[model samples]
Target: MKLVSVETPEKSVCKMTFSASAEELETASNAVYERTRASYTIKGFKKGEADRAQIEADRGEHTFWYDAINDLMDKDVPALYDAALAEHGFVPVDAPVYDLVSVKKDEGFVATATVALQPELNLTKTTGFTTECVTPEVTDKEIDSVLERRRNAAAELVPHKGPAVKGNIVHIDYEGLLEGKPFQGGTAQNQTLQLGSGRMIPGFEEGILGHKAGEEFDIFVTFPARYHAKDLAGKPVIFKIKLIDVCVRQIPALNSDFAKKVANVDTLDELRAQVKQQLHDGKHASALNRAKDQILTQLADAAEGDLPSTLVESTYQLQMQQIQQQLQMQRLSLDRYLSQIHETRESFTAKVRTSAEKTARVRMALLQIAQQENLVPTEEEIDKQLAERAERTKKTLEEVKAQANVHAMRRNEGIRKAADWVIEHSTIEDK
Candidate 1:
């Protein structure tokens, strides 16, 4: 192989032209013929035994030319690109794009490979950024909220004979009619629904408010125009409700018995302490994450680099796929989610483009920092991470290995180490 010229026509993009020897071209052609000879037949030879010349004559001179050139390029271009990249001393962010210029039997082949390299940065300052870290505080309200949730979970429902209110479970038999005709899925017998839970239509819960048990009354409500049911959208429905029972939750007293039953703590004070500590730990973790994010953002903002479009697009698509997976887990469709967020596909992509570019830039900066600080993650670190991940996810080591992108994981560890280095080197103020 021979390198004709290497050019940097754009920031982060490297273009190289190279030529292969005729001998190498011939070898590649032979390899391609051997790989595909089973599908060819010649008059004087068996299917797989047909020689290259015979197949070419039977087909055309240009038949194997493209495949042969591709085979040679595929085998050689990446190495050639890597050598050029090494000479230039720049890391690539994306795979090289190859364009075959010419291919001939005796003249060999010429091709061009273009690649996107990590951009150079002129970081004003990687460190010495003054920032305040909030000391995570567990508020009394937060503790009360947790206690309320636990109390609600432990509560029992008892029959009540008063007007239905919020937090009360109402048992009712109802038949809904649209345009004076019964609609499908609009009738339920003795269904229990929590009032003011917003599980039903907007007005359904509100209409049931102040209604006592054993009352037969009509509740009028209109479905929203964006309702999932097309036929029922924006339609008025009258539900003839026969309230059978109203039940209110009986919460357990916040005593030692309650503490023992709820969280295995022997005393209420101990339970409160445990809850407060849990909340504090959670808040501290969240606050630390936010602080890290702020630091990264400041670093990224100060760091100057040309982002490769290919890497940006890849990051954007990966983010979108994650969003799709999350929506699927929530039993929602992407289209429905977009509608709820008041965004279109193009608009959402446009919005993601900005963050994607920033992410790519931040990743490159982190990698650069890792390299400068010699903060590469060791094999033992990776193994420990994988093991911990497998244990936490309840998956086998092999399963975790199969699902993980080794390159990304390594880079992640490197980034983590880089962040740690920055945190250690920089001064922090507690707020």
Candidate 2:
């Protein structure tokens, strides 16, 4: 196979014309004849024993030529395309559209393929940006919030005759009926639920509030539009609930005994100090994340280049697939999710495309920076990163290495190194 010519008549597109030798076409035609001879029975010859010439004479010359061309496309186009791509130093962003220009018997074939090329980037600026980094300080209220959670976890539930209130556990016998009929997995006896918690559907929990113990009543609720159950989604249902008991949660006082019960610390002061330090560490991590986002956003904003639509669409598709998978895990469909978001498919895709384009632009800028600064990761660095990933994923090093796309990972690490370089060189004022 040979690339006869290459042209870039359109933006981000490359068209390559290819030609093949007569010997290759003849070989392909003969192979197709041999494979399909059993299905044809020609006079004076047994089945599967007919010659290519005989079959061509019996059928039209174009009969085997079609199969031959298809076989060539299947067996040879990929390698030919790769060679053509290498000669032009272009990376395709999607599948090429192939057009057969001519196919003559024993004269080989002529074909052209057009493909979207990956955009080449020219980054104007990646460093020298000044930004404020605000590391959040642990507040007394935040520490108190953590202590309250601990208190709730250690609280005791005592039976009460009073009305159900927020933070109180209410035991009930209930049956959820859809259209006046009890549905599957919608009935429970002696079910304990906390008021104001979002464990039940929207109106169910709120309706339980203010209702006294031993009260038998019915509450109506409409399932969410994107509810996991397809049958009950967006449907109104009545829950006949008999309150069995109301258990008020009694939290212990914040003293030495409570501190010892909640944590290993012997005193309340020590526990408070520990909680403050933990909150500080968490806030510091979040601050670093915000700083990274700021740096990347600044870098992307500084970039000046047109992102390839093919790449952007591909990225959008990948993100959509991830969201779809997440929704499937929750027993919801992507269509229902879109309905809940009040968006049509086109609008949602458009929104995703915008985000994808921005992401692609940032990636391209960082990649160019990586190339300019020689920020390529070494084999040792790659191996170490893979090892760490393997440990975190609880997989063997070989398994992780086998499953990993090494080239993509290398590029990602290089981009990250470039980002780190910029962060190190830039001025970061603490605010």
Clashes of 1: 0
Candidate 1 structure quality by residue, lDDT tens digits, 1-431: 77899988877877899998888878777888888889887788887787778888988876676787877766666667668778988666655677888878888888987777777777777787656668667888888899989998999989888788898998899999999999989999989899988999899988888989889999999999999999999999999999999999899988899999989989988999999999978877777777777778777898886777667777888888998899999999989999999899888878878888887777788878887878878778888889999999999999999887665677777877887777666666666
Worst 10 residues of 1 by lDDT: 422-431
Highest TM-score: give the candidate number. 2
Q: How would you encode candidate 2's per-residue C-alpha lDDT over 337-379 as one tens digit per residue? A: 8899888989988887777777777777777788789997988
Predicted structure 2, TM vs. truth: 0.55
393 in model 1: Cα distance from truth in Å? Answer: 14
Q: What are the RMSD figures for all models against the true structure?
A: 10.3, 10.0
lDDT of 1 at 104: 81
Task: Look at candidate 1 and give me any clashing residue pairs.
Answer: none
Question: Could you estimate the TM-score for every candidate?
Answer: 0.54, 0.55
Model 1's alpha-carbon lDDT is: 0.83
- Per-residue lDDT for 22 in model 1? 83
Q: At residue 375, what lDDT does model 1 achieve? A: 89
Candidate 2 stretches greater than 4 Å from native: 1-82, 91-118, 135-141, 156-251, 322-351, 379-403
